[model samples]
Target: MDGSVMQDTDLAVLLHQVQHRTASPEIVSSDCSASPPAVLPKRVAAAFASTDGDSDSGGDSLLRPKKLRKPTDSGGDSLLRPKKLRKPTYAARKEEIAALLEEHRLLQARLELLRQNVGIPTSYDHDTLEAAQRQQRAMEEALRLQQFALGNTQSLFSKHMNALEPNPLKTYIHLTTDAVERRNTLLSIRREKLHRCYQFVHERLHHIPETSPYHVEERYVNAKGDRIISRFERLLFPGVQDVKQVFNALLFYLTNMEISISETLGHVTVRDDIDAVETRVSNHRVVSSTSYGIELELNAVHCYEYYEKFEEMGGQEFAME
Candidate 1:
């Protein structure tokens, strides 16, 4: 009977302790509801939730899903937005008009200056001025030819000869049929002489060594040493016996015919006529050739002398219709 009573007492005390523990939580919850709940700092709550592993049951309510933030693009927004264009102000329009007027004034000034420089009168039309210039040039050319025919060598046209202006009067005087025939005959005789001289020089060069100098270099050495003399120098200063004889014959013909070598290359051709006589001396040989038109003119004195020589040479005469 004593053991039963003790067991019932222990059982009742354990049940009362269990009921008290369960009711104590309800009372605390009701008190928390009745008053305002205690606010925890965000950083403290986050630290407590992360550090305490058992906080899932209680702290899950404190952490609502973080509100997602959309990414911002300022540059893209600015680009997508339409730009508002401002209307031009009265002052800006006035400035543009002023600048255009200034440019117009400058262009007009330049045009006026150009007209003055070109000697184009404001009253004259451009085509009229051009026609006048053409007429003036024709008159000048006519006057020049008249002066040239009258034996005026100091004419304005002759002064500008270096400017490459062709003289029609000179061409007419030198390129006539009679002039061409006489010049061709004279040139043929000269050509024959040149050929003979070339043959002699070519033969002489063959007899000399390859090392023998043809052109003048080191005057003392060339004059003293066994160097070949150029035809030009031989013609000018005849030292060798054979060269003197050859040049003497050429001089006699030149004097009798009254023909002068006016050019450095021993060519006598009319002005404005293209004539070339190329002669290259190298390697014991003389290669000479001529090209283009050959023309010349003779005075009355020379013409008589030329006919006399032609008769002496027994040239056949032909009548021109």
Candidate 2:
């Protein structure tokens, strides 16, 4: 029995030591790098801790809230997407639209004013006005036709003059002799005719004083001793008396004539040769005849077929009364 009591006391001492260790809090070092970690009581460890709601019991609290990683751009697909357009505000363009509307109103008012100002006569009968306009147009057309007829009459004279122009090639072809030789002979004859005409005029002015209208004085006194000055005074009509002037007048008169004394006397080859004595004198004869009141007679057969046709076509309007 004594031996049993000593064993029970020993057992009670071991139970008390265990209770004391459990009751006292363990002093664990936070610096666990230098010393080994103090052993924890395996009885009240993680296995016994609640894992359902307590966030501080495990390493869950230390983990950061993972930022949601943005989706990466897959290649050119992002660039190909159409950009969304921003909505436009009506307030921003309201003033411009108002200005346009105001302009339209002003334009409408101007158009109305213009329409009122142009006062067209609406009282006249349309057919009467049309007939009056037609009569006025006909009168205007008649006046235009009269003016055209007058213009054509004036142009007819010019056309006749143009027809009288000589062709040099035709004249050359007509001459049988060398053109240069004929020209030289014609020039000599012209010079002689001009000298003779000048002498005749000079003699007539001094010798035949009664026939000539001009009276010439042979003697005149000036600062220098007695000058033999030919002072010619015209007692009749005013006329050119110069040799060159008289020569031109004679040629103009004789150029179109069929017969003349100069032509009969002059041994001329080409009819176009104005320097021939016949041509020069023929022109002079015409002038002399015209001056002496000789009437030019015209004797020709009448063929009025073309003239009748011309008169039918309104040419009678251009005829002199």
Candidate 3:
């Protein structure tokens, strides 16, 4: 019986030591130096501890699966959450946009105003307007070129005519002895004829009645101190007809006189030369004439035809009245 009691006490002591080692696992690690302490998983340790009748309900709290506590707004743990992007707003650029819109409005208004002033219809689009502007520029350029060409032609023609004109003051010293006397006689005859023609024109002018169609104006004097007729006007009368008739009569008379003189001199070549010079000079004068009222001038082609007809007619007098 005593032996049985000793065995029971020994069993009780072994049971107490196992309970102490399980409660404090660090003591088992320190006391045992020969082998490494075996680690028990939290689940296994909690299961073992739960079997102990003396273990408190709260003893397994450390091993229980932890309930995750959500991070608070004030905590640094909130930094782990993904940030949500805020939508963009145009409020910051509102002033800039408004200013740009205002400027665009003003520019549109200015463009419209410019179009109106330039005579461009509002119905025209940008492309049409640009085309019109280009056309206008082209027309202006063409007109400028035309004027330039006209100016150049006038100057060149004037120089050519001046060069061709014979100087009345020049002496014919280079003429052969045989032709000199004949040439002097022809020149004297031409001078006398010209003086007689001038006297005839002067007499006609002086004889014009107060009620006559022709009204002559003496405004200046010529280089030879002779009075120059500046203008001729027709009297306002019931019977006053076309002034062209009077001009035709005078022209016919002068042309006939000139032909008569040339025939008397027996110089057909000189007459032909004089006709050509007169035609050229008259044509140039016609082109340059800016006189008002009666259009007495004829173009070069017409002047040529007029001289041909005059020659064909044998210098017949054209009746004025």
Candidate 4:
């Protein structure tokens, strides 16, 4: 067998074995991490020159073919390799994914807004806001309740007071009765101290004449500072004792120690109702001397000596006892 033919036969056998294998084609590998080989590009081939024997002259070298690659003029070492596009990518079905992502973003925003709204206290902020509102409402309600209660209390108080008012005529009448009661109680008391005090005051009792013992004397002063005296009769109501004057003067003289009745007694004389005179003189016991002047100014108020001492009911305390 010829050597060349034997070499050719071996090469053919190897090629046949490689073509029959079931494995699919492999992608081209690159060491520089350049893009994967494209379908077509400018091809570079290895060159060789032939040396002519015995001289520096050269003949054409063998034309070596090279594997083609894709080219890019862009200023990048490499571009991202596109993955082999699948059915989803090839069909361009991305609208649904975009919509889902958008919905998710919206949900996050809604959750943030819900956190700001007031509700049952899950946190301190919510608790504070709710408590403040509750307190404000409670204060308003309390104020309203207080006003209502005040109104009701005022109305009730007024009604009660009105029902309990004392009558004017009965008021003075009651005062006189109380004084009589005091006198009787004091007299009845066996206590020597109380009896002595009551008797002393009791003797001063006299019916009050509208006229007073004191007189107002008016004097006119000249520029030289000298004074002139105008003497007047004691002012009197004619029938107070019914005797007019003389009897009042006698009683005044007899009862008072140093106290002098006004001199008007010398001018007017005589009387008829001895009992009336006696009654007037008798009513003056406790209050007459002190209260008389005040009575002149206080017309609206009528003064009566209601009690000289306590009533007989265990001594005297008029209103209370």
Give the clashing pairs for model 2. Answer: 262-278, 263-278
Give the per-residue lDDT digits (tens) of candidate 3, residues 204-261. 5765674667764535444456543445455543554644455565556444443554
What's the CA error at residue 97 for candidate 3, in Å? 12
lDDT per residue for candidate 1 within 97-192, as digits (tens), equals 999999998998888778878986643466788989999999999999987777665454333532332312122223234655645644444434
> Cα deviation in Å at residue 53, candidate 4?
38
In Å, residue 288's CA in model 3 sits off its true spot by 28
Give me the displacement of residue 187 in model 2, in angstroms.
1.6
Worst 10 residues of 1 by lDDT: 276-285
Overlapping backbone residue pairs in candidate 3 total 0
Measure candidate 3: CA RMSD: 18.1
Off by over 4 Å in 3: 1-58, 63-124, 165-321
Q: Which regions in candidate 2 have their CA more than 4 angstroms from the true location?
A: 1-176, 210-249, 259-321
**TM-scores of the models, in the order given:** 0.17, 0.18, 0.26, 0.21
Candidate 1 backbone clash number: 0
Highest-TM-score candidate: 3
| 68-150 per-residue lDDT for model 2 (tens digits) | 76656764567677778765677658877999999998997776666557754332345679989999999999999999999
Q: Ten-residue segment with the worst summed lDDT in candidate 4? A: 44-53
Question: What TM-score does candidate 2 reach?
Answer: 0.18
Clash count, predicted structure 2: 2
Error of 1 at 308 (Å): 6.8
Q: Which is the leading candidate under lDDT?
A: 3
Better of 2 and 3 by TM-score: 3
